[model samples]
Target: MIELAQDSGIWTATINRPEKANALTDKMLTELAEIAEEAGQPGGARLLILTGAGKVFSAGADLDAMQGGLATSPVWERLSSAIAALPCLSIAALNGTVAGGAMGMALACDFRVAVAGADVFYPVMKRGFLPQPSDPARLAALIGPARSRLILLVGQRLDAATALDWGLYDRIAQPGALMDAVRDLAADVLAATPQHVAAIKRLIP
Candidate 1:
């Protein structure tokens, strides 16, 4: 399940299927993409935050759905690309570990802050499936090609400390402080006019 909440100029989207580690089904991915598309429109949010309801941000594609062709679905690319193209700032407030295709959305965000003790990895290699199209390039841009290779190709799992050190995560927060850290980052943008936020974000890329 996906839940979206908006306040002031910030929008927070929470992955709510924590019982399954927030594993994403095809429908959930499509809904996220549509929400992102909406956020990029005229008079939309100034900051968008992606997070999860429980400990894990996402376990990636749902296990049962993966066998039904969800793994190679074009929806992953659609969702991540939409997030990357958002006019406002996008942040992945990783509440916990991120794995498999879930890495795409977080990688597309402008910033990522993970909770302490969390891990990050995309084990597509061991899973016998190539990652979503834009994932490798986006990940390589943030953490470097060698490190990206270590995760995607070698299936290495990175703890939060290591992820921050390698630039995979911009900051690490205690679980209780995760949303506070995210809101702190969003404050200035939230105060600015939507146009100003979009213009400044456009200047970055």
Candidate 2:
């Protein structure tokens, strides 16, 4: 499930299925894509924060959904692209481990910050599937090709420290401070005009 909240210029999207580690069903994924698309529209929020409830950011595609063709669905690509193309700043405030396809959206964000115990891994190889098309280049851009291969090819799970060291996460916050950390990261963008934020982001890539 997805829960969206708006305050001032900040928009937060929380994956609310904590009992299931926030595993994404096709409907959930599609909803997320729609939300991202909405954020990119005129007069949308200037800061979009992607996070989750409970202890995991997301366990990736729900098993049944994956079997139902969720793994190969274009929704994944669409969601990430929408986020990446936003005129505002996007941050993945990782609450916990991000596994499998969930890594795609997180990587697509302009910034990623995680709690101390968070972990990052994409099990594409182990699952006998390929990642979303833009995901690999995004991953490599953040952490480099060799480290990207270790996760995508060797299935290594990088803990918060290692992920930060390797450039997957930009900052590590303690559990209770996750939102505080996100607000801190978003402060500047939230204060800036939408045109200013979009101008800076466009200059990046």
Best by TM-score: 2
- Model 2 lDDT, residue 73, Cα: 96
Report the error of model 2 at residue 124, Å. 0.9
Please list the residue runs of candidate 2 whose C-alpha ends up more than 4 Å from where it truly belongs after superposition: none
TM-score, candidate 2, is 0.98
Per-prediction RMSD in angstroms?
Answer: 1.0, 0.7
Q: What is the lDDT of candidate 2?
A: 0.92
Q: Could you give candidate 1's per-residue lDDT for residues 1-205 as a string of tens digits?
A: 9999998768899999989999999999999999899999987768889999888999999999999999999999999999999989899999999989999999999999889967988889999999999999998888789989999899999999999999989988865899899888877877888788778878885
For model 2, where is the 10-residue window of minimal lDDT? 183-192
For candidate 2, write residues 64-87 as lDDT tens digits.
Answer: 899989999999999999999989
Clashing pairs in 2: none
